[model samples]
Target: MASINQLTFIKPKQFEWHEVPAPTLQNDGEAIVKPLAVTRCDLDLYMASGMYPMQGPFAFGHEIAGEVVEVGDGVKGFAPGDRVIVPFQINCGACDNCRRGFTNACTSVEPFAAYGFAPTGERKWGGGLSDLVNVPFADAMLVKIPDAVSITGAAAISDNAGDGYRTVAEPLKQRPGADILIVAGLAQSVGLFSVQAARALGAGRIVYRDYDAGRLAKAKALGAEVIETQYSPDLRATEEFPIVVEAAGLPDALTFAIRSTQPCGICSGVSAGMSNQAKVPLRSMYMKGITYTIGRVHARTEIDHLLDCAHCGTINPDDVITRSVPFSQAADAMMDPDIKIVFERD
Candidate 1:
């Protein structure tokens, strides 16, 4: 066991890293991956801050670009030394939900069963941030990282990048030259990924709103007309968008997207049910004829499409990754409040 299974948690802001037993393959279809680079999602940061409803000291992360260390007899597609991505959710490929392309809601596993999220009785898997993490249904769940894309670039593909790809690319694929408005708050990387994905799909006039000046600058660099706005319901009063995405994962941000969308426009959200009372403007949404979508990402189902863009350099995830650090200093990096943080192994 390399470094054992390390546990890192936020008491709510402070984090601790220590040794636990490394995970092992429990099933014939399972594989053990030693994560080479583990990335943090904004959700992790939010949970760390103790704002959400879940209790912690659970596995600390869910995103990674890692190397396969061991594989069970039933696993045929991957072997030791193969670099792969472990998506946050676990889906059995043969299930009805997975066959229909909804792995996030797969009937074979407990609802929202992923490596992250505080371990409830229904789900309990070690996070990928540790040395050796188990991946069940490995042949179906794991997606290989393209050689052209760096480990840092591929880090978020399991969830953030793939979700952002679906969020922007699928909607705008037919609407050539359509304009986009992105309201980004807590979902720092996905927000930026949407910009890149939208640009790759031939979007026009992407206008991004975020409070972080650094993030706004990164968005600007990615060809979006960026604005730094404080967190409020009134992010804007008049700007109507054809395609609007609220990757920030805030109810207020969703409301802001709803409030600003044009009639019959699509307003997609990156999060669902983070707040007890989100207070939607149902009347306004109905009047405007909005189409909205929010929830878990079907990462395994969508990885191929995104990888095509990545292979040709159509989307640049590396540009948005603001900081890279040694895995040992991950606690410091997590506390630094970077927009996107990728941790490398020794």
Candidate 2:
């Protein structure tokens, strides 16, 4: 039996690195991966603290830039000793959804086939923080990390960073040459990702509103004008925007995004923790003709464009990673107060 150390939950809000069965090739198309760099999600905090749902034998994490160690006979486009980024979502490329380029909603895998945080399919696949992970559809899901981009930096693209690119790319199609407004927060680092994505997508202008002074400074460093909305919840710029990205998954943040959007504008929210039941201004949204899009992302679909941005130094998610710890220290790294943590070896 192939077993290795992986992070698993012993109790709610607690984790430890324990040796478990390393991921095996369950199918002919499967591949085994060893994470060179992995990260914790903002949602992981909620799951760890029992704020969200939980079940037995909880596995943690999904963001990773990993090295391929083994490939099955059917695997294509990858082999042993190749560096790659494993998307947080599990997808089979030949499925109907994937054939149409919507890999996030692929049907070959069970619906909501994703890794980590007490979600379903725990027994079927391993999490990103594990010493080894089994990838079911290697050709479809695995994206090569560009030569110029460091593995640590590429780790973020497995989820947060790639979603950031999609967050703006979806809206830009509707309103070309328009500006974008991002209501960002610490949830999942999507906030900072929005700032980075908007700039790379060639928005006419970008404005980031966040309560965190430090995050605001980081936004400025990313070439976005900043609005410090800490003490003032009702505050907003007088001018509205054509594309508004609500990356902050906080209560009333959606309301604010809807209110601040220009009439007939597009507002896309990246936060998954949003309440299905809440005080949403539906009437206002209808009256303004706002188009609101929210849900999980197809990280692999948007990875190529992000790869270009990273290779040329257009954006640096590594700078946003405030903490770097060894893989043995990953469980402890989750307790960090920093914006982001990347687990790597010395």
Candidate 3:
């Protein structure tokens, strides 16, 4: 077995370099991949903050874009050296949920076990942050990376970008051309994607509110109308946007989003905030007839549409990636707030 290097979060505020055996074909349908690029999810912060119910000494991270290094004998439709993006959520395409277009919720794997969490397959294969990873049900889980997309750019799309697209675009099918309000955090990737996704959905107007000036600047550069923190106290007075997206991972932001949305409007809560309980104004939401949708993303349903938008130049998600760091520095890069960081091996 070949030795591989990996980053492990042994405890909160602690990370150590460890030498582990490289992953090999564990099943006839599995594939081994060398990550071309990887990234940290906002939920990682929750785990580090001791807010999430995650066990320690586990591999962390989910978003990955990589080159296929090896494929098991049973695998078809993919070959070695193919570049692909591994979505954080794994699924078997043959399952009923997957056939119904819910790949993220596939029944073959343990509930919510992807990269950065516990092992779901035969081996304890971790996320893309490692030198090599084993992807179970490879034929169903991998998507070929487009030639036009850079590895760093494609990395973001695997998770947050896809998430932002699903949160707004999927809901918009039921409510088209509705105004959008995104209450996001400046420190995370979701805010940046929210800015781009809203525009691609033909939103009548997009309003973004964040505490970070740097993020607000980026949002403005992306053509989103910026609402600074000073205006947050009176977010309800600005305008009644029918669609609201809560990506900040903060409970307060969710509350604000619920209050700002109009009656019969939809508020998509995409944050994985550690808090189990949220204080919502039930009376207000009930009286105003507001609707709320929350939980993990459904990216497979929207990836094709998002790719079409990207191919036609209707959306440019690459703009949200502010920095690309080498895989060695990913740990430090994630701690920095100045830029949205993407990790590349080469």
Candidate 4:
């Protein structure tokens, strides 16, 4: 077995790399991938800080783009040496949910499968933060990276960009040209992607609320009107947007999203923390006729279109990548507040 090194969270605020056996092709539909580039999901930070409860010693990454090194006998439309982006959610393409285009809630894998999160025991595949990873249901889970798209640029599409697009674009289709309110953070990629996706979806106006000046500035640079606020007392006082996205991954942001949206508007969230106890103004939502949906992204649903937008220069996803670090420095890079880090294997 080839030895693969992976970063694991030993305890709160601590991380270390450990050597383990590289994954082997366990099924006829699986493929072994050596990730070319990887980026931290915003959720990983929560798991690391003990804000989210997770079993210890699990592999710790989700977003990845890589080269396929091995393909199972039943794998089709892919081969060794093919460059591809792995969707963070695992799904069996033939299920009812998959057939209906709800791959994020696939029945084959537990509620959340991809990386970092504990497996549903249906598939042995872990997160993508290693030298090698086995991707089951390869035909449904992998998207071939376009030759025109750089590996680094394609990396975020596996999760962050895809989540952002799905969260913003999918719902906005029901109500186009509505004002969009985004609750996001500087360290979080989902917020940044929300801003870009909202703009791409042709929202009448994009208003963002965040405490980080850098995040606000970045949002502004991407054509969003940003407001810096503490989100205290009532976040609704800051702005009233017709459509809202809670990408902040905090309870407060969720509250803000429900309160700030206009009556009959849509609110979509990708905040992982919502799984825990979170207070939502149910009475307000009921009275206002507000619609809410939150969870893991159905990446395949939006990645190809998002990639097309990125390739055409209409939306530059690379603008959100604040820094790139060698894979060996993954832990330190995550701790760095200076920039959002993208880790690449050297």
Candidate 5:
């Protein structure tokens, strides 16, 4: 068996490069990939900081754009050397939910089967920050990176960027030129990417709120009207928007977003870490007839449209990356305060 080095999260605020057996094709439909550009998701910070409450000693990092190294005989549309974005979720395309484009709820694998996280599945699929990884459903889960998107820019297209698209793209299509409000702080990249997606998809005006000066500046640079304010449950939008996004993973932000939606409007909550005891503004939501959605992103379904926008220059997710480090420095870089970071390999 061949061995390779993988970044492992041994404990909170600690990481190590551990030697692990290289992945091999277990079936004809599988493929092996060598990640070239791997990006960190906002959840990584929570997980590594011990806020997410997940056990460690598992491979870390997942957002990936990689070169295919080997493919099984059954693999067709891809070959060795092909560059692809690996979705964080493990999905068999033919499953009922996957066929309906709900790839996140794929039934063929265990619930929430995914790479990087230790609890996602029984067998580790390995993390993107590794010498190699196994793609059990390559044809279903891997998307070829378009020529217009560089490898670095394509990294988060597999997850964060796609999650942002899910927030506003379809809603904007329903109500073109409608103004949008994004309440952001916790999920930093996803919030900024939401601004980028809204701009690319024809949203008329975007108002982004965050306490961080750097993030507020980035949101402003992305063509959003910026509002800098501390997180307060009392914070409320003076005016309702047809589309509202709550990326801050707090009950207060979520409630504020619900109250900020226009009548019959949609509020997309991208945060998943809010307390279970958080209260929903049931009376307000009911009276306003608003639609509130919160869950994991269906990345495989959203990446295609996101890549099209990227190809057309309507959005460049590369701007979301605040720091870039060599693959060798991934373990140390994880402890930094950068809003977004990518590890690159030659």
Candidate 6:
């Protein structure tokens, strides 16, 4: 049996390359893929640093852009050598939830069956950091990378970019050219991606708020009006917006996001590591008739649209990728404080 090296998380702030059995197509719907570019998700950094509680000894990547090396007999949409984007979550694509565009809550697989992390169910789907990965439901799970998009730049589209897309896509559709407010501080990629996504989606006047000078600079470079500020739980937003996004995973940031939404406006939170017990201003929400949405992203549903944007050169992932390194430097890149990093293989 052929084996490949996989990046595995051993403990907080620790990871190693380990040899693991390479995967093959188990059924006609499955396909074998070789990851070419993998980007770090904000959750990866949090989990690796012990900021987020997650057990390790699990394979370590989820966001990836890869090439199909082999396809099962039933696989029709893809063939060997096709460059593709693989969504983080596993879904059968034919299930009720998936058909309804809720791929995040796919009914065909055990709840939360995802790549790049520990097994949540009986099956262990390997992470994207491996030399090769097995993708079940190939036709349903894979989206070919656009010819106009850079393979390395599109890597984060697997998760973070899609997550960022959802922040502004629907809201902008509801109110085209509306100005948006994004509260970003902790993580760098998602918020920056949101700014670009909003621009592509026809949003007007993107205002990004964060205390990190580095992130603010990145936001400004990405065409967002940057606001520098500190986080406080009691913080109140002085400006109002029809669309608000909270990317900073802090209770204070969430509160500020809600306060910033105008009456009948919508707020989406892409933050992780927020306390479950955080309070919402129900009275204000009811009086203002505002809607707040927060949860895991249905990444598969938005891939094509984001790719379309990428195709037209409206949003370039390279703008947000602060660092790009060869695969051998994965360990060192993961520990560094760079805003966004991409690990690529030749």
Clashes of each: 0, 1, 0, 1, 0, 0
Tens digits of lDDT, candidate 4, 1-346: 6688888767667788988877898779999999989887776766677666676767778788999999999999899999999877787888999988888888876776666666666555656668888888889888898777878878888888888887778667878888888887632778888888888878888888888888888889989888887766465544666778887767777787788888888888776463657777899899989888877677766677798778777677788888888888887766566435678888
lDDT of 3: 0.76
Candidate 2 per-residue lDDT over residues 1-346, each given as its tens digit: 8678778876766787777877778788989888888866667766666665567475677888899999999987999999999988888878778877787888876777787755554355667878788888998889888888889888988888887888888788777768998988746477778788777767888998888877888889888899877523575457789899887777667678888899899999786553556566789889999888887888777777788888888777786777788877777767666777888843
List model 1 lDDT by residue over 1-346, tens digit each: 5458465674777667778766777889999998888878777767777766567677777888899999999999999999898878888888988998888887887777888677645647778678888888898888888889888877777778887888877668656788999999778888899999989988998999998888899999999999877757666556898799888777677788888788898888887736766777889989889888776678878787888999899986788888888877776666568888888886
In Å, residue 57's CA in model 4 sits off its true spot by 0.7
Per-residue alpha-carbon lDDT of candidate 6 for residues 1-346, written as tens digits (9 for 90 to 100): 9999998988888889999988988999999999999998888887788877678789988998999999999999999999999998998899999999999999988988899888888888988888999999999999998888888777888889888999999999899999999999765689999999998888999999998999999999989999998989778788999999999988888778889999999999886444557777899899999999988999898787788889989988888988887887787678778888888984
**How displaced is residue 217 in candidate 5, in Å?**
0.4
Candidate 6: the clashing residue pairs are: none
What CA RMSD would you report for each candidate?
Answer: 2.0, 2.0, 2.2, 2.1, 1.1, 1.2
Q: Comparing candidate 2 with candidate 6, which one achieves the higher TM-score?
A: 6
Better of 1 and 2 by lDDT: 1
Task: Write candidate 5's Cα lDDT for 101-141 as tens digits.
Answer: 99999998888888889866678878999999999998988
TM-score of 2: 0.93
| C-alpha TM-scores of all predictions | 0.94, 0.93, 0.93, 0.93, 0.98, 0.97
Candidate 3 runs further than 4 Å off = 49-53, 119-123, 230-237
Cα error, candidate 5, residue 227 (Å)? 0.7
Query: What are the runs in model 1 whose C-alpha is more than 4 Å off?
Result: 1-3, 231-236
Q: Could you tell me how far off, in angstroms, the CA of residue 223 lies in candidate 4 after the best superposition?
A: 0.9
lDDT of model 3 at position 117: 76
